[model samples]
Target: MRRKVRNYILIVISMVTGTVSFAQTEIENPFGLVYRDAITENLPGKVNIQPVTYTLNGIEIAANVYTPANYDPDKKFPAIVVAHPNGGVKEQVAGLYAQLLAEQGYISITADAAYQGASGGTPRNVDIPHNRIEDIHGMADFIIQYEGVDSERIGLLGICGGGGYSLKAAQSDKRFRAVATLSMFNSGVVRRNGFRNSQVNTIQERLKKASDARAQEAAGGEVIYAADNAIPTEEAELAKIPYDLYREGYIYYGNTHKHPNSTFRYTMSSLLYLMTFDASTNMNLINQPLLMMAGSKADTYYMTDEAYRKVTNAKDKELFLIESATHIQTYYVPEYVSQAMEKLNVFFGKYINSEA
Candidate 1:
């Protein structure tokens, strides 16, 4: 099984390289968005998308903002800051939800994190926890100041790894009135303990390698990366992956929803900081209204469950489960996405929408 998975990964690497080469020309959407019914043009009187860029802590962030139909900049409107998953860009799941929320009459903004996607950062693909958390905060900083946005009605929606960061960001960032997560992935815990604690015995060993990677970077040596290998070529090999999150994630990020900017790799030195961080820690700091959703059958659901249980001080905190859906399914599957959007609309409406 291990050997098959490895072989499959090798195939994935070659395919990804080829996909990146022709992505710009082959993609049907003008904006390079891969999701269903993505915005093709900025039509007036409908949900419109605007590509925007802003500097965040010396790094430029690439972002997309969605406005509701017949949007008037003179009138106040509630806003949401949507954060993409690890290795995901603004054109994927994050943008999907942002557009969906806009259809529900809320202004939404989704941005590529620094050092990843199209955001400007040196030594790209760095996945430190603090930086990701700041990305969510930066999104809020920019969105609240956008035209037609009511600063006080700002909410947050983080998907997958972004969901975990949203928890940490909303912990002390009182600017967000409502906070939500979909298929939350606790990156720090997974990095330190491995998915489902699969690498428990190798914790210290991995830490040493991360330290070595950092030392090599200090000496200006070659940059080392983790998870930069190929993925399965056959369905049988993909099924061999022990976790549903990984098995489906490969298909979602590597094939059906492949984007040139998306990648599974992160700087090896990043693990030095990633291993020490814990998204579930300081959970009590999130005093805002909270809503967390995950697939009932998702292998990654445990992380969301654990984190949700820790939000003792959060107001009206709720844990929603999308039955029969897996982690990656919530990203693009129409049925699962509709369920999530329905719940999000109600939750965000009650907390952030002025009409509620």
Candidate 2:
């Protein structure tokens, strides 16, 4: 199974080199992304999307704000900040959930992390856990002041890696009235131990490599990074295991739902910081209402389960699972998404409506 995965990764490398040719075809302006509620020209209804930008730590952060139907600035409305996955941007699952939440009568916003996607940051795709958590705080800083957003009623929803960071952000940032995560991925754990500890023995070796990468950068050497930079069509046909999130993720991010800015790689030097962070270390600090949803069948389920167990301070918490959905499946599968959003609507509605 690992060999099959590795071979496909090689294909991604080749495709990245020839990205220009592949991009010209099916991949158009925003890149060939076809998820529901995706922002096209203009959405007609009680929900609408607007491109917005704000500065975070002196860097420009790109974001999309989804407003409820017939939005009125004179009136106040609850708000929710949606954080995208690790290899995702605000235009993918994060945007979908944001739009859905907007349709449910809350102002929703999703943003590209400072160093990833369209956001501004030097040395792209750094994937530092602290920066990610700060991005969530930055979103809160911006959205709490948005027109029509009721400061006391703001909520948060983080998907995948963003989910992990959200937990960390909520630890100290009491601004969020409620917190929720879907398909929560512990970025620190996965980075340090590999998926399910498959590479646990290589922890020190990887750390040394990351240290070397940082030193090389300090020496003014060419920036060294890591990522699956290519997407090959042929690899999709090879026999693969069912419910493999990475396999489905490659197809989703690289092919069908491809976004030019989304790639599954980060600076090799980032591991030095990533390996030392833990999203759940201060989990008890998140005293707000918490809702964590994950696919029961997802191999990444353990991360969510463990983190959920450590969240002993949340006033209320629930680990809702979509019975058969895989990790990536929760991102785009209509049925699963609908299920997750339905839960979120209730979760946010109940908590965001209640005040201190």
Note the Cα lDDT for every prediction shown.
0.88, 0.82
* lDDT value for model 2: 0.82
Error of 2 at 265 (Å): 1.8
Give the Å error, residue 183, model 1. 0.4
Stretches > 4 Å off in candidate 1: 1-27
Q: Which stretch of 10 consecutive residues in model 1 shows the poorest summed lDDT? A: 1-10
Error of 1 at 327 (Å): 0.5
lDDT of 2 by residue, 162-253 (tens): 99999999989999989999999899888999888888999999999999999999999977886667654554442243436676677678
| TM-score per candidate | 0.92, 0.89
Backbone collisions counted per model = 6, 3
